[model samples]
Target: MHDTTHHALQRQRRQVIWGLTLIAFGVAYLLQRDDGDAVVRLWQYWPWVLVAFGVNNMLPPTDGRRFVDGLSQVLFGAWFWITIEGWWGLNFGNSWPLLIIVGGLGMVLQPLAHRYFPRHQEERS
Candidate 1:
Protein backbone atom coordinates (compact mmCIF):
# COMPACT_ATOMS: atom_id res chain seq x y z
CA MET A 1 0.00 0.00 0.00
CA HIS A 2 2.80 2.42 0.78
CA ASP A 3 4.54 1.58 -2.44
CA THR A 4 1.36 2.15 -4.37
CA THR A 5 0.87 5.50 -2.74
CA HIS A 6 4.45 6.53 -3.43
CA HIS A 7 4.16 5.51 -7.04
CA ALA A 8 0.90 7.37 -7.42
CA LEU A 9 2.39 10.51 -5.95
CA GLN A 10 5.40 10.27 -8.24
CA ARG A 11 3.13 9.84 -11.23
CA GLN A 12 1.09 12.84 -10.22
CA ARG A 13 4.18 14.99 -9.80
CA ARG A 14 5.39 14.00 -13.25
CA GLN A 15 2.02 14.85 -14.76
CA VAL A 16 1.99 18.26 -13.15
CA ILE A 17 5.52 19.04 -14.26
CA TRP A 18 4.86 17.94 -17.79
CA GLY A 19 1.60 19.80 -17.94
CA LEU A 20 3.30 23.04 -16.87
CA THR A 21 6.10 22.47 -19.36
CA LEU A 22 3.63 22.01 -22.17
CA ILE A 23 1.77 25.13 -21.18
CA ALA A 24 4.98 27.13 -21.13
CA PHE A 25 5.90 25.83 -24.55
CA GLY A 26 2.50 26.70 -25.88
CA VAL A 27 2.79 30.21 -24.53
CA ALA A 28 6.21 30.59 -26.02
CA TYR A 29 4.91 29.43 -29.36
CA LEU A 30 2.07 31.92 -29.29
CA LEU A 31 4.43 34.69 -28.30
CA GLN A 32 6.78 33.75 -31.13
CA ARG A 33 3.95 33.93 -33.63
CA ASP A 34 2.84 37.32 -32.39
CA ASP A 35 6.26 38.95 -31.91
CA GLY A 36 9.60 37.37 -32.56
CA ASP A 37 11.27 39.91 -30.29
CA ALA A 38 9.05 38.84 -27.42
CA VAL A 39 10.19 35.26 -27.82
CA VAL A 40 13.80 36.37 -27.93
CA ARG A 41 13.32 38.33 -24.76
CA LEU A 42 11.60 35.34 -23.16
CA TRP A 43 14.65 33.21 -23.98
CA GLN A 44 16.65 35.31 -21.56
CA TYR A 45 14.67 33.81 -18.70
CA TRP A 46 16.06 30.30 -19.29
CA PRO A 47 17.73 30.27 -15.89
CA TRP A 48 14.31 29.98 -14.35
CA VAL A 49 14.20 26.44 -15.71
CA LEU A 50 16.95 25.43 -13.33
CA VAL A 51 15.11 27.07 -10.45
CA ALA A 52 11.93 25.25 -11.38
CA PHE A 53 13.72 21.91 -11.50
CA GLY A 54 15.26 22.65 -8.12
CA VAL A 55 11.85 23.40 -6.65
CA ASN A 56 10.56 20.15 -8.07
CA ASN A 57 13.39 18.20 -6.51
CA MET A 58 12.61 19.72 -3.13
CA LEU A 59 9.00 18.70 -3.30
CA PRO A 60 7.37 16.67 -0.54
CA PRO A 61 8.58 13.14 0.25
CA THR A 62 12.04 13.87 -1.13
CA ASP A 63 15.19 12.84 0.78
CA GLY A 64 17.69 15.21 2.34
CA ARG A 65 20.19 14.67 -0.46
CA ARG A 66 17.63 15.58 -3.09
CA PHE A 67 16.51 18.57 -1.06
CA VAL A 68 20.04 19.86 -0.76
CA ASP A 69 20.68 19.26 -4.44
CA GLY A 70 17.54 21.21 -5.24
CA LEU A 71 18.52 24.04 -2.95
CA SER A 72 21.92 24.31 -4.62
CA GLN A 73 20.39 24.36 -8.04
CA VAL A 74 17.98 27.08 -7.03
CA LEU A 75 20.73 29.19 -5.54
CA PHE A 76 22.96 28.69 -8.57
CA GLY A 77 20.17 29.54 -10.96
CA ALA A 78 19.25 32.72 -9.14
CA TRP A 79 22.87 33.75 -8.89
CA PHE A 80 23.50 33.11 -12.53
CA TRP A 81 20.39 35.04 -13.49
CA ILE A 82 21.44 37.96 -11.36
CA THR A 83 24.91 37.93 -12.84
CA ILE A 84 23.58 37.91 -16.34
CA GLU A 85 21.34 40.84 -15.55
CA GLY A 86 24.28 42.72 -14.09
CA TRP A 87 22.51 43.20 -10.81
CA TRP A 88 24.74 44.97 -8.26
CA GLY A 89 27.59 44.91 -10.79
CA LEU A 90 27.86 41.12 -10.56
CA ASN A 91 29.19 39.30 -13.58
CA PHE A 92 30.48 35.88 -14.53
CA GLY A 93 34.02 37.06 -13.87
CA ASN A 94 33.39 38.14 -10.30
CA SER A 95 30.49 35.90 -9.32
CA TRP A 96 31.85 32.55 -10.41
CA PRO A 97 33.03 31.73 -6.90
CA LEU A 98 29.42 31.62 -5.78
CA LEU A 99 28.97 28.33 -7.56
CA ILE A 100 31.65 26.75 -5.41
CA ILE A 101 30.21 28.38 -2.31
CA VAL A 102 26.75 27.01 -3.01
CA GLY A 103 28.17 23.54 -3.61
CA GLY A 104 30.09 23.62 -0.32
CA LEU A 105 27.01 24.81 1.51
CA GLY A 106 24.96 22.02 0.02
CA MET A 107 27.53 19.44 1.05
CA VAL A 108 27.46 20.70 4.61
CA LEU A 109 23.69 21.06 4.79
CA GLN A 110 22.79 17.70 3.26
CA PRO A 111 24.22 15.69 6.18
CA LEU A 112 22.58 17.94 8.75
CA ALA A 113 19.23 17.80 6.97
CA HIS A 114 19.41 14.02 6.82
CA ARG A 115 20.28 13.80 10.50
CA TYR A 116 17.38 16.02 11.53
CA PHE A 117 14.62 15.18 9.03
CA PRO A 118 15.39 11.71 7.81
CA ARG A 119 13.91 10.38 4.64
CA HIS A 120 10.64 8.52 4.67
CA GLN A 121 10.99 4.82 3.85
CA GLU A 122 8.40 3.29 1.63
CA GLU A 123 7.59 -0.34 2.35
CA ARG A 124 8.00 -2.87 -0.44
CA SER A 125 4.82 -4.25 -1.91
Candidate 2:
Protein backbone atom coordinates (compact mmCIF):
# COMPACT_ATOMS: atom_id res chain seq x y z
CA MET A 1 0.00 0.00 0.00
CA HIS A 2 0.99 3.65 -0.36
CA ASP A 3 1.23 3.95 3.39
CA THR A 4 3.82 1.18 3.52
CA THR A 5 5.92 2.81 0.84
CA HIS A 6 5.74 6.16 2.55
CA HIS A 7 6.86 4.66 5.84
CA ALA A 8 9.70 2.85 4.14
CA LEU A 9 10.83 6.04 2.47
CA GLN A 10 10.78 7.90 5.74
CA ARG A 11 12.79 5.17 7.41
CA GLN A 12 15.35 5.20 4.65
CA ARG A 13 15.74 8.98 4.87
CA ARG A 14 16.18 8.81 8.62
CA GLN A 15 18.81 6.10 8.30
CA VAL A 16 20.67 8.16 5.74
CA ILE A 17 20.75 11.20 7.96
CA TRP A 18 21.90 9.12 10.94
CA GLY A 19 24.58 7.43 8.92
CA LEU A 20 25.90 10.71 7.55
CA THR A 21 25.94 12.34 10.96
CA LEU A 22 27.89 9.44 12.44
CA ILE A 23 30.35 9.53 9.62
CA ALA A 24 30.87 13.26 10.10
CA PHE A 25 31.46 12.72 13.79
CA GLY A 26 33.91 9.94 13.13
CA VAL A 27 35.85 12.12 10.73
CA ALA A 28 35.86 14.97 13.16
CA TYR A 29 37.20 12.68 15.85
CA LEU A 30 39.98 11.45 13.63
CA LEU A 31 40.94 14.97 12.63
CA GLN A 32 40.47 16.55 16.00
CA ARG A 33 42.82 19.31 17.05
CA ASP A 34 45.39 18.96 19.78
CA ASP A 35 44.17 19.75 23.32
CA GLY A 36 40.68 18.49 22.31
CA ASP A 37 39.43 21.89 21.21
CA ALA A 38 37.86 20.12 18.24
CA VAL A 39 34.93 19.01 20.31
CA VAL A 40 34.43 22.54 21.46
CA ARG A 41 34.51 23.73 17.91
CA LEU A 42 32.09 21.04 16.87
CA TRP A 43 29.64 22.28 19.46
CA GLN A 44 29.06 25.31 17.24
CA TYR A 45 27.41 23.06 14.70
CA TRP A 46 24.29 22.34 16.76
CA PRO A 47 22.28 24.41 14.32
CA TRP A 48 22.86 21.65 11.79
CA VAL A 49 20.49 19.50 13.82
CA LEU A 50 17.69 21.86 12.89
CA VAL A 51 18.82 21.88 9.30
CA ALA A 52 18.64 18.11 9.25
CA PHE A 53 15.15 18.16 10.67
CA GLY A 54 14.08 20.72 8.08
CA VAL A 55 15.50 18.61 5.29
CA ASN A 56 13.63 15.61 6.63
CA ASN A 57 10.37 17.49 6.50
CA MET A 58 11.10 18.38 2.87
CA LEU A 59 11.42 14.80 1.65
CA PRO A 60 8.29 14.06 -0.41
CA PRO A 61 4.51 14.00 -0.70
CA THR A 62 4.41 17.64 0.20
CA ASP A 63 1.20 19.05 1.63
CA GLY A 64 0.36 22.70 2.30
CA ARG A 65 0.86 22.41 6.04
CA ARG A 66 4.03 20.40 5.75
CA PHE A 67 5.34 22.73 3.06
CA VAL A 68 4.92 25.72 5.29
CA ASP A 69 6.35 23.90 8.28
CA GLY A 70 9.32 22.72 6.29
CA LEU A 71 9.98 26.18 4.93
CA SER A 72 9.83 27.58 8.43
CA GLN A 73 12.28 24.96 9.64
CA VAL A 74 14.72 25.70 6.85
CA LEU A 75 14.46 29.42 7.42
CA PHE A 76 14.88 29.07 11.17
CA GLY A 77 17.86 26.82 10.72
CA ALA A 78 19.53 29.23 8.34
CA TRP A 79 18.80 32.12 10.66
CA PHE A 80 20.32 30.26 13.57
CA TRP A 81 23.31 29.30 11.52
CA ILE A 82 23.89 32.87 10.56
CA THR A 83 23.41 34.05 14.11
CA ILE A 84 25.84 31.49 15.45
CA GLU A 85 28.40 32.31 12.82
CA GLY A 86 28.02 36.02 13.35
CA TRP A 87 27.77 36.46 9.63
CA TRP A 88 27.18 40.11 8.75
CA GLY A 89 26.96 40.74 12.48
CA LEU A 90 23.60 39.00 12.78
CA ASN A 91 22.71 37.69 16.23
CA PHE A 92 19.73 36.97 18.40
CA GLY A 93 19.77 40.37 20.07
CA ASN A 94 19.86 42.25 16.83
CA SER A 95 17.96 39.89 14.52
CA TRP A 96 15.13 38.60 16.66
CA PRO A 97 12.75 41.10 15.10
CA LEU A 98 13.48 39.62 11.70
CA LEU A 99 12.17 36.33 13.00
CA ILE A 100 8.79 37.84 13.85
CA ILE A 101 8.59 39.61 10.52
CA VAL A 102 9.57 36.56 8.51
CA GLY A 103 7.24 34.31 10.44
CA GLY A 104 4.36 36.67 9.91
CA LEU A 105 5.21 36.92 6.26
CA GLY A 106 5.16 33.17 5.92
CA MET A 107 1.80 32.99 7.61
CA VAL A 108 0.38 35.63 5.37
CA LEU A 109 1.78 33.99 2.25
CA GLN A 110 0.71 30.43 3.04
CA PRO A 111 -2.87 30.84 1.93
CA LEU A 112 -1.80 32.30 -1.39
CA ALA A 113 0.74 29.53 -1.91
CA HIS A 114 -1.87 26.92 -1.15
CA ARG A 115 -4.31 28.56 -3.47
CA TYR A 116 -1.86 28.52 -6.30
CA PHE A 117 -0.81 24.91 -5.76
CA PRO A 118 -3.76 23.10 -4.32
CA ARG A 119 -2.95 19.86 -2.57
CA HIS A 120 -3.90 16.66 -4.31
CA GLN A 121 -6.11 14.28 -2.36
CA GLU A 122 -3.89 11.27 -3.05
CA GLU A 123 -0.88 13.09 -1.62
CA ARG A 124 -2.70 13.63 1.66
CA SER A 125 -2.94 9.92 2.36
Candidate 3:
Protein backbone atom coordinates (compact mmCIF):
# COMPACT_ATOMS: atom_id res chain seq x y z
CA MET A 1 0.00 0.00 0.00
CA HIS A 2 2.77 2.37 0.76
CA ASP A 3 4.48 1.67 -2.54
CA THR A 4 1.22 2.18 -4.36
CA THR A 5 0.76 5.52 -2.70
CA HIS A 6 4.31 6.53 -3.49
CA HIS A 7 3.88 5.60 -7.14
CA ALA A 8 0.66 7.57 -7.34
CA LEU A 9 2.33 10.59 -5.84
CA GLN A 10 5.16 10.37 -8.35
CA ARG A 11 2.65 10.21 -11.17
CA GLN A 12 0.81 13.22 -9.86
CA ARG A 13 4.01 15.17 -9.59
CA ARG A 14 4.99 14.33 -13.15
CA GLN A 15 1.59 15.39 -14.45
CA VAL A 16 1.81 18.69 -12.65
CA ILE A 17 5.27 19.35 -14.00
CA TRP A 18 4.28 18.53 -17.56
CA GLY A 19 1.22 20.71 -17.40
CA LEU A 20 3.21 23.63 -16.05
CA THR A 21 5.89 23.23 -18.70
CA LEU A 22 3.34 23.20 -21.48
CA ILE A 23 1.69 26.33 -20.13
CA ALA A 24 5.04 28.08 -19.87
CA PHE A 25 5.93 27.18 -23.43
CA GLY A 26 2.59 28.40 -24.67
CA VAL A 27 3.22 31.75 -23.04
CA ALA A 28 6.72 32.00 -24.44
CA TYR A 29 5.46 31.16 -27.91
CA LEU A 30 2.79 33.80 -27.74
CA LEU A 31 5.22 36.37 -26.41
CA GLN A 32 7.75 35.69 -29.14
CA ARG A 33 5.32 35.57 -32.05
CA ASP A 34 5.11 39.31 -32.33
CA ASP A 35 8.86 39.83 -32.55
CA GLY A 36 10.32 38.44 -35.76
CA ASP A 37 13.89 39.40 -34.85
CA ALA A 38 13.60 37.85 -31.42
CA VAL A 39 12.29 34.65 -32.93
CA VAL A 40 15.20 34.52 -35.34
CA ARG A 41 17.77 35.24 -32.68
CA LEU A 42 16.31 32.54 -30.47
CA TRP A 43 18.30 29.91 -32.35
CA GLN A 44 21.42 31.15 -30.63
CA TYR A 45 20.10 29.91 -27.30
CA TRP A 46 19.82 26.30 -28.40
CA PRO A 47 22.27 25.12 -25.80
CA TRP A 48 19.52 25.71 -23.27
CA VAL A 49 17.95 22.48 -24.47
CA LEU A 50 20.99 20.58 -23.27
CA VAL A 51 20.90 22.44 -20.01
CA ALA A 52 17.27 21.52 -19.60
CA PHE A 53 18.09 17.88 -20.22
CA GLY A 54 20.86 18.07 -17.65
CA VAL A 55 18.51 19.55 -15.11
CA ASN A 56 15.93 16.88 -15.77
CA ASN A 57 18.48 14.19 -15.17
CA MET A 58 19.51 15.76 -11.90
CA LEU A 59 15.99 15.97 -10.56
CA PRO A 60 14.91 14.10 -7.39
CA PRO A 61 15.63 10.38 -6.85
CA THR A 62 18.88 10.70 -8.72
CA ASP A 63 20.97 7.56 -9.36
CA GLY A 64 24.11 6.50 -11.16
CA ARG A 65 22.70 6.60 -14.67
CA ARG A 66 21.00 9.90 -14.05
CA PHE A 67 24.16 11.37 -12.59
CA VAL A 68 26.19 10.38 -15.65
CA ASP A 69 23.56 11.63 -18.05
CA GLY A 70 23.25 14.88 -16.13
CA LEU A 71 26.98 15.39 -16.13
CA SER A 72 27.13 14.81 -19.88
CA GLN A 73 24.35 17.27 -20.49
CA VAL A 74 25.99 19.97 -18.39
CA LEU A 75 29.30 19.46 -20.09
CA PHE A 76 27.71 19.49 -23.51
CA GLY A 77 25.77 22.61 -22.67
CA ALA A 78 28.92 24.42 -21.59
CA TRP A 79 30.80 23.26 -24.67
CA PHE A 80 27.98 24.38 -26.91
CA TRP A 81 27.90 27.76 -25.24
CA ILE A 82 31.61 28.28 -25.64
CA THR A 83 32.10 26.86 -29.13
CA ILE A 84 28.83 26.99 -31.03
CA GLU A 85 27.53 30.14 -29.35
CA GLY A 86 31.01 31.61 -29.33
CA TRP A 87 30.52 32.94 -25.84
CA TRP A 88 34.25 33.36 -25.25
CA GLY A 89 35.41 32.88 -28.83
CA LEU A 90 36.61 29.34 -28.08
CA ASN A 91 37.54 27.09 -31.01
CA PHE A 92 36.08 23.60 -31.23
CA GLY A 93 39.49 22.06 -31.82
CA ASN A 94 40.87 23.60 -28.70
CA SER A 95 37.75 22.72 -26.71
CA TRP A 96 37.67 19.01 -27.52
CA PRO A 97 39.86 18.26 -24.53
CA LEU A 98 37.13 19.53 -22.23
CA LEU A 99 34.83 16.80 -23.45
CA ILE A 100 37.48 14.21 -22.71
CA ILE A 101 37.93 15.54 -19.23
CA VAL A 102 34.21 15.53 -18.45
CA GLY A 103 33.78 11.99 -19.77
CA GLY A 104 36.76 10.75 -17.80
CA LEU A 105 35.50 12.34 -14.65
CA GLY A 106 32.07 10.82 -15.07
CA MET A 107 33.60 7.37 -15.57
CA VAL A 108 35.82 7.70 -12.53
CA LEU A 109 33.28 9.18 -10.16
CA GLN A 110 30.14 7.22 -11.04
CA PRO A 111 31.34 3.96 -9.49
CA LEU A 112 32.60 5.60 -6.33
CA ALA A 113 29.42 7.62 -5.94
CA HIS A 114 27.20 4.61 -6.47
CA ARG A 115 29.23 2.63 -3.97
CA TYR A 116 29.12 5.32 -1.30
CA PHE A 117 25.70 6.83 -1.89
CA PRO A 118 23.57 4.12 -3.39
CA ARG A 119 19.93 4.90 -4.02
CA HIS A 120 17.39 3.28 -1.71
CA GLN A 121 16.42 -0.18 -2.86
CA GLU A 122 12.81 0.22 -1.77
CA GLU A 123 11.79 1.59 -5.15
CA ARG A 124 12.92 -1.59 -6.80
CA SER A 125 10.58 -3.67 -4.67
Candidate 4:
Protein backbone atom coordinates (compact mmCIF):
# COMPACT_ATOMS: atom_id res chain seq x y z
CA MET A 1 0.00 0.00 0.00
CA HIS A 2 2.83 2.39 0.85
CA ASP A 3 4.56 1.54 -2.37
CA THR A 4 1.42 2.27 -4.29
CA THR A 5 1.07 5.63 -2.64
CA HIS A 6 4.69 6.43 -3.34
CA HIS A 7 4.31 5.51 -6.95
CA ALA A 8 1.22 7.68 -7.24
CA LEU A 9 3.06 10.63 -5.74
CA GLN A 10 5.95 10.15 -8.12
CA ARG A 11 3.59 10.02 -11.05
CA GLN A 12 1.87 13.19 -9.88
CA ARG A 13 5.18 14.98 -9.57
CA ARG A 14 6.19 13.97 -13.05
CA GLN A 15 2.84 15.13 -14.41
CA VAL A 16 3.26 18.49 -12.75
CA ILE A 17 6.73 18.94 -14.18
CA TRP A 18 5.66 18.02 -17.68
CA GLY A 19 2.59 20.21 -17.47
CA LEU A 20 4.69 23.18 -16.43
CA THR A 21 7.16 22.50 -19.20
CA LEU A 22 4.34 22.43 -21.74
CA ILE A 23 2.92 25.66 -20.44
CA ALA A 24 6.29 27.34 -20.64
CA PHE A 25 6.71 26.27 -24.22
CA GLY A 26 3.24 27.45 -25.06
CA VAL A 27 3.95 30.88 -23.61
CA ALA A 28 7.18 31.07 -25.53
CA TYR A 29 5.32 30.19 -28.69
CA LEU A 30 2.84 32.94 -28.07
CA LEU A 31 5.63 35.42 -27.54
CA GLN A 32 7.29 34.32 -30.71
CA ARG A 33 4.08 34.75 -32.61
CA ASP A 34 3.66 38.26 -31.29
CA ASP A 35 7.24 39.28 -31.98
CA GLY A 36 9.31 37.50 -34.61
CA ASP A 37 12.56 38.61 -32.99
CA ALA A 38 11.52 36.77 -29.87
CA VAL A 39 12.43 33.52 -31.56
CA VAL A 40 16.00 34.64 -32.05
CA ARG A 41 16.28 35.71 -28.42
CA LEU A 42 14.68 32.49 -27.23
CA TRP A 43 17.15 30.44 -29.22
CA GLN A 44 20.02 31.87 -27.21
CA TYR A 45 18.35 30.87 -23.99
CA TRP A 46 17.92 27.19 -24.90
CA PRO A 47 20.34 26.02 -22.24
CA TRP A 48 17.86 27.15 -19.58
CA VAL A 49 15.74 24.13 -20.46
CA LEU A 50 18.51 21.90 -19.22
CA VAL A 51 18.72 23.90 -16.01
CA ALA A 52 14.99 23.52 -15.50
CA PHE A 53 15.13 19.78 -16.06
CA GLY A 54 18.03 19.50 -13.68
CA VAL A 55 16.14 21.33 -10.99
CA ASN A 56 13.15 19.11 -11.54
CA ASN A 57 15.33 16.04 -11.17
CA MET A 58 16.71 17.34 -7.89
CA LEU A 59 13.24 17.65 -6.43
CA PRO A 60 12.16 15.67 -3.37
CA PRO A 61 12.59 11.87 -3.28
CA THR A 62 15.67 12.05 -5.48
CA ASP A 63 18.35 9.43 -4.96
CA GLY A 64 22.10 9.60 -5.52
CA ARG A 65 22.07 8.88 -9.23
CA ARG A 66 19.22 11.27 -9.90
CA PHE A 67 20.85 13.98 -7.83
CA VAL A 68 24.16 13.56 -9.62
CA ASP A 69 22.45 13.61 -12.99
CA GLY A 70 20.58 16.77 -12.05
CA LEU A 71 23.72 18.44 -10.76
CA SER A 72 25.59 17.64 -13.95
CA GLN A 73 22.76 19.01 -16.06
CA VAL A 74 22.64 22.30 -14.13
CA LEU A 75 26.42 22.71 -14.25
CA PHE A 76 26.60 21.92 -17.91
CA GLY A 77 23.69 24.19 -18.74
CA ALA A 78 25.16 27.11 -16.82
CA TRP A 79 28.58 26.51 -18.29
CA PHE A 80 27.20 26.39 -21.78
CA TRP A 81 25.25 29.56 -21.23
CA ILE A 82 28.29 31.31 -19.85
CA THR A 83 30.45 30.15 -22.72
CA ILE A 84 27.96 31.26 -25.34
CA GLU A 85 27.50 34.61 -23.67
CA GLY A 86 31.30 34.98 -23.28
CA TRP A 87 30.86 36.13 -19.73
CA TRP A 88 34.09 37.06 -17.96
CA GLY A 89 35.94 36.48 -21.24
CA LEU A 90 35.16 32.77 -21.17
CA ASN A 91 34.26 31.02 -24.40
CA PHE A 92 33.84 27.48 -25.62
CA GLY A 93 37.44 27.15 -26.74
CA ASN A 94 38.86 28.15 -23.36
CA SER A 95 36.15 26.84 -21.04
CA TRP A 96 35.50 23.42 -22.58
CA PRO A 97 37.63 21.72 -19.95
CA LEU A 98 34.97 22.63 -17.40
CA LEU A 99 32.72 20.06 -18.97
CA ILE A 100 35.25 17.36 -18.26
CA ILE A 101 35.64 18.61 -14.72
CA VAL A 102 31.89 18.58 -14.18
CA GLY A 103 31.68 15.02 -15.45
CA GLY A 104 34.44 13.97 -13.14
CA LEU A 105 32.74 15.66 -10.23
CA GLY A 106 29.54 13.78 -10.88
CA MET A 107 31.38 10.48 -11.14
CA VAL A 108 33.17 11.12 -7.88
CA LEU A 109 30.16 12.41 -6.02
CA GLN A 110 27.61 9.76 -6.93
CA PRO A 111 29.18 6.93 -4.96
CA LEU A 112 29.80 9.14 -1.97
CA ALA A 113 26.22 10.38 -2.04
CA HIS A 114 24.91 6.86 -2.20
CA ARG A 115 27.19 5.77 0.61
CA TYR A 116 26.11 8.53 2.94
CA PHE A 117 22.48 8.73 1.94
CA PRO A 118 21.38 5.24 1.24
CA ARG A 119 17.74 4.85 0.24
CA HIS A 120 15.36 2.74 2.21
CA GLN A 121 15.03 -0.89 1.12
CA GLU A 122 11.31 -0.42 0.77
CA GLU A 123 11.85 2.59 -1.48
CA ARG A 124 14.27 0.59 -3.57
CA SER A 125 11.86 -2.26 -4.00
Listed in order, each prediction's TM-score against the native is 0.82, 0.76, 0.68, 0.81
lDDT to native, each model: 0.79, 0.75, 0.70, 0.80
Q: Return model 1's CA RMSD, one decimal.
A: 2.7
**Once model 4 is optimally superposed onto the true structure by TM-score, how far is the C-alpha of residue 125 displaced, in angstroms?**
6.9
Name the candidate, 1 or 4, with the larger TM-score value.
1
lDDT of 2 by residue, 40-87 (tens): 888788778778867786667554555576777888888988999999
Best by TM-score: 1
lDDT score for residue 83 of model 1: 89
For model 2, how big is the CA root-mean-square deviation?
A: 2.7
Q: Which residues of candidate 1, in runs, are more than 4 Å off?
A: 1-8, 121-125
Q: For model 4, how does the per-residue alpha-carbon lDDT over 13-121 read when each residue is reduced to its tens digit?
A: 7688778877887888786887878866777777888888888777766667777898899999999899889999999899989999999999999988677546633
Whose TM-score is higher: candidate 1's or candidate 3's? 1
Residue 33 shift from truth in candidate 3, angstroms: 2.3
Error of 1 at 95 (Å): 0.6
Any idea what lDDT model 4 has?
A: 0.80
Span of 10 residues, lowest total lDDT, candidate 4: 116-125
Q: Name the regions of candidate 4 deviating beyond 4 angstroms.
A: 1-11, 120-125
Off by over 4 Å in 2: 113-125
